[model samples]
Target: MQTTGISYSETSVRGRSRPSSFRQRFKHSASWLKGVAVALTLGSLLSGCGVVNHMIYKTTGDVMQGFSRDHTIPYLMASGDLAMGCAMSEATAPLLMSFGRVTNEPDQLAVMLYLSAGGCAEEQGREHELAALAAMYERKGNAAEDAIIRQKRAYSLAAKRYLKGWQHHNTYYGEPGTGECPDFDDDMDEFIYFAGLLAGLQALNSEIQSTSSIGVPKNVGSVVARASSCLESDKWWGAPMALKATVWAMIPGAQPEGEDAFERLAMTDRMGDEAGVRLSHVFHAIAATNKGDEAMVKSVVRQHAESLKEQPANEDWAFVDAMATNMIIAISDRLWVENTGHRTPLGRLGTFWDDQKAEVETMDLDGLL
Candidate 1:
């Protein structure tokens, strides 16, 4: 037979015959190997030097910005927890600033970075102010003077940082460079816009606290009032309410008819509790202190302390929570220092009133007798 010269298996795989299944499998395996090789080569090329880390930071920052814009920010605003929000911004400052340094583009991330840095500077300014108070209480002549000088430097630093943030916001938003008020469309936009406003207000506050005269426009209150009306009272967790109340308390004849400042301040507590953030209470406490209303200040502080015990700051917003606690603790510390010549006792920041030993009145009266 003619098939005697060829094996049956070889003859079966001759011209026009299907290839063996093993051969097909091997071909597929080879193709897959080539594909994997190409992928690895491309990956190596893309991951060269700082490219990977830069891309990672960029992507992460973008995701975080989106998260903050959509979820975290709205929740924080509605909860009146801007302290935590500020803390969030502050925590991401280094990453954001580093990104800004690498790129010259003025994107939202850049604006946020500047704002966060500005907020941190403002907080540091407040810290310096507290140190000044502490030094003044110490009754050390040159020490108080040195503290005052440091406080002034901090205030100046805060003003510069805030101005930079405002300028960045204005530039990115296509607004006037003179720090003129800008408009916003949605809640996120409004929140960012308000941050610029707060930055300006902080600068003014620092200047005022330092007893230095800056060229802030006299019509700043009118601008703030106009912008305050744009904020949705329900969505913003009574931030507008607290701000208006503060304005009324600070400025002469600013309170509207039939609207009491203290009552408006009280309303913030209710709204703040519903939003799970009570930063408005801090604002109210500050106003009360400025007004020399010791009773109101004590009541506000007590309420803040009790609220903290009942509900601690959310872990997701840990930085913000810490900031809120720190702010209130600072207020308490000031009160303690003014009264007892010391700071709030260890681990007793929010619960300063609970410790009888720390009370100024409890100090040994027998020694005086």
Candidate 2:
């Protein structure tokens, strides 16, 4: 209803090279509306609510299968596809890069480039440029100093260009803090939340770890704070709430209020309440990572496990299962590290628990005890 109210049927001739008369435009609009009416009538007559319900059941069943070792690649790939499918343009590249690419989507290229510029990749093409700046700062020569300054200028200019271009072409939320984020014009808040989280996380990971020059610790920290505020205000119903909570847990010293937003939803006992169930895992993960109260984490996870076990597994439930399973594994790994020097009660956590070394090597993160 909110989205429908905001939908202003734009004149078809507006974006065209040749303009049309008001009468012609009105006729075209009428034809389009008539076609929509016919399509809806045919759809309702053919299937009814049963058909719609069945489709909903199928979609839910598919989404609830979370990530496990056997399906890590597939899960990540599918999440990537969904992210890209929902993305309207290149401005959303920061989030798109979270999952690796499959095909050559045009929007993906800019996302990749942004990552390269920020040193998100190992062999980024822009690494040479970054290194050149480093070399200039390292030496005592005029040309070298000039080169470093020029490189800095170039990077800044490119970023400004991208921001301006995104503002001009993007139909969704424009650059944050342009007074564009608060506008309730559409149901694309999911996309907005995803993008904001991606950007905020990018800034945090890069700046906090000292891997990037563009983001400073103070700046990244503030970004996280802002993101948490945005996420809280956004219209997250289920899994989106769990996902946002998971990201919020990663923010250092972040303690946002309204942790009970998901509970307000009148979710049925069906696995369609995946967000509610999946949130338990996030709570556990937060408690594990931050070395917070263990009792609270265990209580949430156990509560959900008991409830979820009673629910029927629908296709959409797969997404919830994957998310919960991954969170459990992550929490277990954290517990092992904290309790027994990275040794689990089951066994030495081997490949599954060895994220520390991988994260260090891949992201250049400091592995603090």
TM-score of each: 0.65, 0.36
Residue range 252-368, candidate 1, lDDT tens digits: 888888988889889987776566567678778878987999778878877877777777554444344455556777788878876666788886655444346744556787999
RMSD of candidates 1 onward, in order: 13.2, 23.3
| Clash totals, every prediction | 1, 17
Candidate 2, 1-369: lDDT as tens digits: 255533344555556533346568989999999999999998887778767776765544333212221243233323423223223233444433333232222222333234323322211213334444445444536654554445455544344323322322233344443333454444333333344443444444433323335432344434433434444422332433444444455555444675532242112112233433343344334534455656645444444455456553334334335444444544544454444343234532222333346444355357752
Q: List candidate 1 stretches off by more than 4 Å.
A: 1-107, 171-187, 213-215, 314-321, 350-369
Candidate number achieving the greatest TM-score relative to the actual structure:
1
- Among the numbered candidates, top lDDT falls to 1
lDDT of 2: 0.40
Q: Rate the local accuracy (lDDT) of all candidates.
A: 0.66, 0.40
